[model samples]
Target: MNTVTRAHLCEAVYQEVGLSRNESSALVESILAEICDELVAGHTVKISSFGTFSVREKGGRIGRNPKTGEEVPIAPRRVLSFRASHVLKDHINHAPASGDNDADGTR
Candidate 1:
């Protein structure tokens, strides 16, 4: 989802948990900042029911250009990966029970 939608959800969470909008926004910002910091530091972050973010090192390799088909050298780089937690994966793979349902439970 987009940032706006995420913000909206966070706002709802705050409302449910009895926090002000500003406090909720600050909480969201803090968590996001922590994720950014972890990625920047080349560390792996795993949220129990959400996902994981990891930095991987890539070795330099030769690749073929699509158009020219010429050999190109690719430099090594760091990459981040996210693996969904069991709860998140269950949501993704879950099917409705066919009573009354909505995508992503937005209903």
Candidate 2:
């Protein structure tokens, strides 16, 4: 599947829900800002039936320079991860997309 960008995502959602582009963009921005704030605060955001977003910290570690075959020190960083809820996972895993059926209509 092709990845959806923020601008296109806002447009698509607006079309579906009948919201204006401005409203959709603002709403998407607010949601993203809130998610970022929660991550910065070290809190996990769990959207029921969707997934959970959490921030994880990684300590500094050793690294390698493949070109020179030299070891280097890597800085620590924070990463965000999402864990899909069982319901979401089940739907995505078992449900076929539209127009997926054959001539016999057997998916």
TM-score for each prediction? 0.73, 0.75
* Candidate 2 local lDDT, residue 81: 93
RMSD of each: 3.4, 5.1
Model 1 lDDT per residue over 1-107, tens place: 32346567676668677888888878888888999998999989988888988999999999999999999999999988888888998977886477344334441
* Residue pairs whose backbone atoms clash in candidate 2: none
lDDT of 1: 0.81
Q: Model 1, residue 40: displacement in angstroms?
A: 1.2
The total number of steric clashes, by the backbone 3 Å criterion, in model 1 comes to: 0
Please report, in order, the local distance difference test score of every candidate based on alpha carbons.
0.81, 0.85
Best by TM-score: 2
